[model samples]
Target: MTFEMILVIIVITLMLAGLFFEMARPDLLVFFTLFFFIMTDIVSTDEALVGFSNEGMLTVGLLFIVAGAFERSGLVERLVSSMLAKANTRQGAMFRLLVPISGFSDFLNNTPIVVTLTPIVRKWASENNISPFKFLLPLSYAAILGGTITLMGTSTNLVIHGLLLDFGEKGFNFFELAWVGVPITFIGLVYLIVVGHRFLPDHKSLIEKVREKNTKDYLSEIQPWNRQRFFSERCD
Candidate 1:
């Protein structure tokens, strides 16, 4: 086994471990994975970098900007205000107004959905003394789940449908994604509601404690090595 291959294996292991442990956000590791492959000469320069030039990435970035524009226009504020005024509790709000809002995002860009609804959710999270993660996941899951219901719900579905046509298979209809996606989404959601979330990483950065530090402290749940708790001390 070559040293380069060994190094490649280590990088892949680290990336996967981070993802499985939720130590770092998935998007952050994507670049590192690419960089590792490039450094290991696993892919040529052009091949390694070509994905950024793809039209899909540009389209998503543009969509995020457009969504942010709509959010900044205060329409989101008005709508969120109305919903909050009517809902009596946080979970009730999620089930009632927020879940539908997330579903609406499936037909649109999730970036805009995230940007528009994040503030509303943060405020609600604060008012109800709930962690942001508790509701944010529900909000994200709803939007993503709704997207699988229709071909136009997400660009990825459109891309897959196009691929099917290129392969001489029938293309999808508006609701075709839900044929399989609905069941998978439902099962995953039930799992989250039942178990996965109970294990969610709690960084302990509550809404009022939020700062630039907290925002970027993605791995805060992992405590640093102190003398008292160190494996080094035990070994000594």
Candidate 2:
């Protein structure tokens, strides 16, 4: 191959190694990789900066901000808690959780939705004597399926839409993906509820272990300043 292509392969290999080994922050590694390409004249500064100016990237950033605000509003927590409260069985709980998660993901960015709901689902599973593993997979699957339903549901859709617009093509309609997404999401949810949950490991999270330990036996000791003081306080 050409010298430039060989150099690119080496640089990318090193970058992947650094990321896999966690030798530096991910953002720093990516930034430095781009900077290296610019310095080597593999890409012009304008070309390198063009991606940052892409509408898709800006939308993803804005979506993260909006998702953060919504998460902070405590609405998600309340909604999840209310849903879990109404379900007494594991299947019922999974049904309740997955349905809303998929619906929420249709309009919002699914990454934040998954991250925000993970701990809540874990806690609920622990309390109800169900494995967090059982609910966590369904949670992720639901979010992914939900994101497919709308153009704004995931970053990938927006990125593709932006690329299309950049190429002077008409971009996707908001619900253009719903035709396939809706059916796939329905089938995926059914699979998770009917069979997938059965195959998940019953792994207990560290938080659950700690909580159980605390509930069973928690010990504390306090020392008195003096025997006389201790006795006096007791007598008093």
Candidate 3:
């Protein structure tokens, strides 16, 4: 093998090891690896910078801004809360939660959707006497499945679309991926609602544990003091 190929392999192995062990921040490790490659002439500076200018990368950045705005608008929370309002059973709640989450993920980036809903779902589970652990995994899975439904659903899809354009090929239509994504999403949600939740740990959330610990209460009394006397003493 060529020396450059051997060197590239070594660098990649080290980079993966650093990521696995969490030796540094992921972005830092990635940036350092890229810089190392450029310094060694493995990739030209222009080639390294090309990713920054890639249409897909730019679209992902814009989507992050839009996702942040959507989260702050409180629309998702309201919609989800209304859907889950009548869901008394675990199966019902799981069905209601996963359906909207998957649908929303088809348009907006799924990361923020998952992040914004996590606490809300946890609180709902606690209120309904269910474990948050059961819902969290399903929540993530639904988002992933939903993102597959459209080109804009996830960063990976958008990046691939952009790459296809760069290579002078026709890119994916908006709903092109939905043909496969819809069926997989349906099957996955069914499995979670019917059987997957049964295997999750039923551990209490940290907030519940803390609430239990602080259940006992004590009372204390304080005597009133003369304000004029206190001020006079301070002045003297």
Candidate 4:
């Protein structure tokens, strides 16, 4: 195989591995397009750096900061807590939780959202006398599904946009992907509700709680659960 084809294979492997491992440093891969351009001499230095100058990048960053504010301002907590309180069953809570989280994690860091909410969700299940594992996998899966919904929704989406622009082509619109993504999201949610949940763990035990404090006078707590107590300590 040619060197170019080998490099493409390596990149695809790394992307999948990064996502699978939920690696913290995956952000470094965000600049691979720049490296590709430099190696291929696709454009002048100024043209190559234009992605950093685009309003799209700013918009994506602003969305994350806004989401962070939502977390720090008690908004996400209040919203999630409200939903959990009203949910009479674990399944019900999972259905409701999917909406915000799928959208939020698609844009922001999926890892943080997953980690932060896992304990809260476990507490909800504990309060309702249900299994947190029934929905934890679904939660992670839903975020992956929903992240494909918009151009600002995921790193791959942004990378695609930059690469398109680099080729002097039009980039994706905000919600164009959502055209197909929404249907996929709905289908995935249905799967979680129906046959798929049978594979979920039967019992989940609460080990500890997750607590958060921010300089902006924000504090939130999550009740932790352990299935295999050892697995909980990996903290990745």
Best model number under TM-score: 2
Please identify which of the two predictions, 3 or 4, would achieve the higher TM-score against the true structure: 3
Q: TM-score for all predictions? A: 0.61, 0.85, 0.84, 0.59
lDDT of 3 by residue, 1-236 (tens): 99999999999999999999999999999999999999999999999998997787888788778767766888766787889998878899889999888998899877777887898888877876678999999999999989999988888898899899999999999999999999998999899999999999999888788777987767998979989999999999
The local distance difference test score of model 3 is 0.89
- Global lDDT of each model? 0.69, 0.89, 0.89, 0.71
Q: Candidate 1 residues 1-236, lDDT tens each?
A: 98878888888899999999999889899787987688868877899866666444555677778778877798777787677668775445555654565467556756567667878777766765667777677667766766676665666775666667657888877776678767766675565555655676544445556753566644447666697668677888
lDDT of 1 at 189: 59
**Which ranking of candidates, highest TM-score first?**
2, 3, 1, 4
The alpha-carbon lDDT assigned to residue 34 of candidate 2 equals 94
Off by over 4 Å in 2: 211-236
Misplaced by over 4 Å in model 1 are 1-5, 17-29, 53-55, 89-92, 128-134, 152-174, 180-236
Mark the 10 consecutive residues where model 2 has the least summed lDDT: 209-218
Q: Give the backbone clash total of model 2.
A: 0
Top candidate on lDDT is 2
- Please, what are the lDDT tens digits per residue for candidate 4 over residues 178-206? 88888988788788766678887776555
Candidate 3, TM-score vs. the true structure? 0.84
Looking at candidate 1, what is the lDDT of residue 44? 77
